[model samples]
Target: MTATSPTPSVVSSVSTLVRSPAPAGLVGHRRAGRSPAPLTTGRARRARRVLAARRRPADRDFRPDIEGLRALAVVAVVVYHAGLALPGGYVGVDVFLVISGFLITRQLLKSVGRGGLRALPTFYGHRVRRLLPAAVVVVLATTVAFRFVGPPLKVRDVATDALFTAFSGLNYRLAWVGTDYQHMGAAASPLQHFWSLAVEEQFYVVWPLVIAVVAVATRRRHLRLVLALLVVGVVAASGWASATLTPANAPWAYFSLHTRAWELGVGALLALAAPRLVALPRRLAGLAAWLGLAAIAVAAVRFTDATPFPGVAAWLPVGGAALVVASGCGPRVGAERLLGEPLVQCLGRVSYSWYLWHWPLLVVAPYALGHALGVGERLAVVWVSLVLAIASFTWVEQPVRLLHWPTWGWIGTGATLGGVVTACSALVMVLGPVTTGTGAAAVLASVDAPGAAAVTVAPAVAGTGPAASAATSAAEQAVARTVAAAVGTVQVPSNLTPLPQDAADSLPPTSRNGCHAGFTAVSQGDCRYGDLTAARTLVLFGDSHAEQWLPALDQLGKAQHWQVVSWTKAACPAARLTVDNPSLGRSYTECDTWRDATVARIGALHPALVVVSQSENVASSSVVPQAFSAATVATVRALRSAGAPRVAYVQDIPTPGTDLPGCVATHLDDVRPCTYDRSAAYRYPDRHAALAPALATASVPVLDPAPWLCTATRCPAVVGNVLVYRNESHLTVPFSRWLAPVLAPVLTTTGA
Candidate 1:
């Protein structure tokens, strides 16, 4: 879970990527073979005080324990992402925050104590060398890998994320999309890990400027008190805000810098008191370090997804990290010794690179394989990420950071790489969906055309009475045979093409017109189609599944002289029943209200016909068929009593467990791997099954789209060379529109 604020997860991204892990051996070590100057009494004493005043603790007070701490944080994050344990492993990011604050603040105060601000060029150059090279390589490589592993739309989304990663603004992009990282039941952006990095970078960029101003204000006075108060003030206010805001606004509290400022501020304050902390007796310091470690351990194991994040809940980890950092400097205790081991230090050394590499691999691997990762596979993911991290550290990070480049050279390198990343991302956007490989296009051409011979399970012959019922079986069987032959004869495309050409903006026209009443909507409304002026209105109403039929409805209305009105909201169906929506993590009051008002609006319109559909996630009393049936009956009865002359309900299509397009891409050589068992799909409970008896009483017919979507024992991702769905359970407009010839007559049949 990355919000790991409503909670922010661990980082290589936004608030997570705090700084270059300085590592154990890099700090507190002098050039090899140099010896301390021989005793010089009075002259040495004066020089010692001068040097102390001139340098910050970070320059001389480096402890290997901090590196071990970094090791712990990154491991918690990795283990959590791999689904091993630690529901709150995301708090490792909060630990990183404190560590970052301590390091940066100590460095700044050292500069201040030395009688001036650190040279900006030198400071920025160091940061650039330490962080930029590895970041650029990772973002560039992730972008390239995404083109192969993801759907075209996903490729576009990841490209945009790559651009944001280059600029360190991925958190803002995620906020715009209302991304709840903990419950990404669908395809998630791999670069979502970078959101934490963005936050950390933001802190890095702004904190220095503020500290520089404060340093100037103190102007060589005893500035510790003033700085401590400033840090305390931020800690108090930001902590209070996080506690207050998180329940109602978790995403904002999780992602926003302001909400998280207190954790970092507290670490900075600890840095201000570093000398006193170090002055403590060894036994007490050892006790504190062990206790702090215990607190962190408890938090890692006990915290859950529902735990309100980064507010008061954060103190457990944040305070523990601060205590360990403060106490670790005093003595080499058992805790310190354990943390200082070679393996731990090595893990800490490559922690940043590991953080950067793990997330994309975790997100992309399962998608590439078309299945969820097992324990062994998850371990492989971690091992591969570790190998890549080691490569990044050795090849990109160490080599560039060790160089003695001039400040301008560092700046130039950063700018050139940044620009290249931006251009590559922009070029992907410009190129649009990669309409690659003429092979699929050729396979689709012969069978995908609207003019291709139309066939299906037929509708009833229109007549006055019993004869229509008698002829129904023959008509349907003839249509079924025709459809089966035509479908079986056509070549199936090995891979699906993300459709609507503008795949990234594939939302329906109603959504654009603000009438599709998504979960964000406050009220119900209508967006009309076909001949808007036509008197005989045909209304398509329900949740997004109903919206999927819009392409067909619009086509039918234009050709058959019926006006189409859409009344839909995401996740809200016309069935009046209490249901749980996991995405919202609540009863979904907004969806309930939208459905009530939408149905009422439909009644008011008194249209010639009303069509309704919903999702399996929706049910009457519960997620059961019988309950949905009762709910469907009650809803339809109300509509009929409210003057709905005729009504129809649609059964949802088969659920694709994985992203259909991504699956197809992974097995482009053959699509056999993408097919799912039809019996299992059909066995899934249907709301329509319960609705049928109720509808029969009211003369409302049921619409089952199964024949077009599945065969007797198999449900394939593709049919007649057209991709059926873009994701788990929604129809692509192109595929929906292609079904018009089969769906038209059935829709025109007036009665049950």
Candidate 2:
């Protein structure tokens, strides 16, 4: 529920703590069978050779500057997430990917050289211990905190995301949902940051097996060539997929591992090439390091959410990280030296925990504090994240990880831990947002219960009989009177009842069958309802705003012996004009194509009435109103050219900028906070004035039900104990159905 928009998922990382090297012949220097040499003659030289042969360079190669780079990456990520002025701070994830690839590949390559597949268990076990503890703690803490602080609507999603993160499948989950990372909105998941961690975890699982199989089983002479080819294939394939997929499916492209493999592959390439680069003259190496850092800085400053990601544009930061790694492979120089300073290195040590701790803190801070974070509050969140990260790294991540279990023990224990988190998420979903303590059932019953005068219309008579037993218009007005009397200067009962329970269900019936075309739908599909066999048919045409009136139209059609059809798509108006989709970050051409197709279908159906309506908020904003007169006139003329009989236009309802379910849930006792001005409803001149051109040009009569929902005073959140609008723009099915009587008289009088 929290993810209204997409941001990248939180990534978990293994701590790269570089402890100070110990004295000669320390614990790691001597092998099991090796003996230390005494400071004697040829015997001492032989012992020294033995000790040198047995020693592993893994500890000695631990690069503090790499840790500093990590620190910088996480800092960019955290600051960017806090709404700080880093448009390309997300590039930090790219940096982390490169670094992880470089370090992990270096480790795996070394292991394969030394012991081939034999070192795999140790490698995997070390990995499990390195990442599991902090991940578990953060996920569990996030789950618990969200349940307590966030609205119930967000609880299930956060739990599911946490579960996905636990299994390193969050990227897949996000891809499935088509989560748009950039501009995905403010309600993004607290555990959204876990997605990157999933990628790293999966890479950790795979890279070892590939290297072990190639290095241990095959000839050492061919290792570099084999890996180079493999890395190239990964980079080429992933980069191609990223380029192809991003335009149509940004979320999938943004989150999918297949698309991101290239960034990491670039790191592996750099790691393989590091020895060559590090052997370069110190002057060139220093220049390369500085250049890499500068590239990263430029990318962070210049790139934005609009920049197509993980394709060629992403090479800036990824290449930069690789250059820095190559230049610093031997010893710190230039930029590497600056990056290796004590404070930065310390931050690098705790960067993984910082990454884990920062996102959830930022996401839930608003709900916990009951308001959006100000600049000071955002800084406070950053401070708190640092403190928690340092604490967790010092306490949970370090001590427990140092225990070093065997391969099977690690695999078993980690899976069990993941299972526990998964089960917790499942339980949260099963328990749901509407439960006993939440009091949602009681609220639902009150809202669904019969209102004053029992506002129900008699069932539609079969075979062209009179629609309703009673005068439907009279019933509608009577229900309206009952509502007004029931609310004598007090909040309406409808707003308080059935809240946050059937909240998402408030959409029209068209939504159930996907009759309402989504943004990317190329063509409108056929959808029919109500007295299907009737000779006369009524078509509802327009965008989702028009689709919201399905309940009302369905009722009117059935009672009047008319079949009903809806050719509607979300945000696709009948008007043939370009409009900006802020969510898609582009002009919506799919809607235009689908809208034209839908109008053609309406013409083919040639129903008794074609009811048209659309939300006008999508029209481009300017100093003057975008009435869209020419486009509206063209669409109406097209409808006329294709059809016969009456065409009615339904004016759009008011648009409010608040989530009504959340507002109603929070202000259940006092619903006035959720109400909007009746005058403000008609304030938008684009759609309102746009209606005039089409009406005058095509001679279409208008059905204005705005008065029935809102009085002269204000438009209440609910009417007659049945909640009205679903969110801010669309009407609730129950309230829309209740308006059948009001619409019946209009349809009857229109000679349909």
Candidate 3:
């Protein structure tokens, strides 16, 4: 998060006090700005006091080092978001929070000291001028730019995020959506980075009032002590909450102000003790500064995406920032000298605007270019954002901040900007939904557009002999007719089963009913699906890939007089390998627990058949296919040992990485672009190859579903007037139900 408040104005306010030349006696005694020789006599001691007075804490003057620190923090964040090697660069937000706490607290405490909260209005006015102008510009620019470059399906999300940013509530919105599994896969919002700005702004609203209350309660005496106690209380409570919640609910812990306020409180504690910290010896101060930098560097280099964050991990960067600010209270150090470099200062100057502009450009560029950006293109985006930030800082930020305006003028400025965002967001929402003009349903119906029939019909229809009909079954013959009629089908049917916009909601009964578990769920709760009273039981087991077949299984089970039980969870693969869930930022212990419980539950059910399916993408980069296959074979053996009469492993469908609904909507006229090559979907290191040998040894049959969903070389996004894959991989409910007839024979046969 960019620290919205800059130090230049604060530094300028105290410049006259610190910038004046030394007295005549000091000029002779002090050589080249170094302090005079150590005082021994009473007269020398008095001169020493004067020198100390001249060397006031850097906090009381323009500390270019603070500006340089801002540069470091923003650069880290940018690099991390740009997919660089610095995994822990996210700690930059912690540094900014601490800095905000220290700087804002200093200003507030000074106000209380002067006139007992008389400066509250002025403090807020300054904040408005400093923060809102540049933010409004970026929000407006992002909304407009995305409107032009982004897909229509994503327009509404970006607009909503922009509106929240304008209202200073983006963090709350992000927190809610971050934990929502349904929306988790949506394209990144351009204004998503504004969540940090929202955090700072929210803190600003509450902290000044706290200072005012403390001053009144203490009768303006012992105010610092009371304030310190209050800050400590906040730190303890928020820190405890962060530590407890991060592993269990990372999104709320990461984005909520309640969990984040402690970092700022740490900075506030430093501000309270600033007056006394100036007495530290120069050597000790220099050491502290270097140690602080070292701590920050260690965190940035050592931590990774899998590290649980914003709890104990945050203390490193937060404490380091405090030390840096505390060091500024004494003398200049090596850290300070490096921080004050011209290039660092320049970066610091426009860091706020750069933070605002960089994320939006990175998100929109791929859509605009119609492809993912290469490393060179990403670097180009970084440069372009820097240029825009410089321009925003020079023109909009300086002009609005320097203007001499009344309180009402500031209020009006905020309202106008907010209004513009609202209007723009409304415009985006109104224009977001796109329709591929209606096509002829008659053409599709006449051809009997083959949905699953594509796989079976092609081979049988190609054969001219009457023996082909004799060779194929009755159900296969029906599929053959649909496939033959739909051979050259290219136009998308007007009567599409699930409209593109609503396609993602095509979940199975188990998913809708509480049978399908969520990420944190450990047990498969009452997941029985069909023919509840049937004598024979069938179990559908694994992750979402298994759940995707539920519509078919449910219908088939009822017709075949078999009970259907669904055991599934989001992102929790049936494979035995332990996963590192990026969302939780840790090893997926919950998944292991769920898998164990599911195995026990299935053992108790003593199902006549257990059909297992898991996503091909389940094995992450760290887990090799051999490990996955071994784990899977073990699971199959365990199932047989637990009384499952038969076990079948269904091969996963080819994953079309593109969002099918959005692609269908965007390329409605030319459906060919929406189809995926079979080779790409079944690319290298195939899960089937790994599992085949082990499964064969275990005598478990492997069922390939490709023959039902695809042709020899490609898989169409839409088939037989029904949308196929809903999002990236899951099949739509309508399509899954259509497969019930084809899937029935395999489930019924003794060999299956």
Among these predictions, the greatest TM-score belongs to: 3
Winner by lDDT: 3
Q: How does candidate 1 fare on TM-score?
A: 0.78
Give TM per candidate: 0.78, 0.83, 0.84
lDDT of 1 at 143: 83
TM-score of 2: 0.83
Model 3 residue 369 CA deviation (Å) reads 2.9
**Residue 652 deviation, candidate 1, in Å?**
1.6
TM-score, cand. 3 vs. native: 0.84
lDDT string for model 2 (475-591, tens) is 554655544543332444533434555566666766766666666777656688877889888888887778878887887778778788888876666777877554444567888
State the lDDT at 587 in candidate 1.
Answer: 58
Winner of 2 and 3 under TM-score: 3
User: How do the residues 1-752 of candidate 1 rate in per-residue lDDT, one tens digit apiece?
Assistant: 21212212223322222344433332233458988678689768655543433332433546678889999999999999889899999989988899888887887776634445555556667678888888888888888777776666577778988998889898877765653311235456888888887887888787776676776787747577777887888889999998986654566678778888888887788878876664555577788898889989999999987777877899999989987887765545668888877678778878999999998898888868978899988988888887777767776887787798898789888889899999988877777454432234433332223343334443332223332353244333433443354334333443434542333244567757777775547585557887777779988878877888898788878877789988887777677876655444445677777767767788898999888777755553335777666777788888887888687777676676666655554445555676776666643455544555565665666656666666656667665556667666777776677665555555666631
lDDT of each: 0.70, 0.70, 0.76
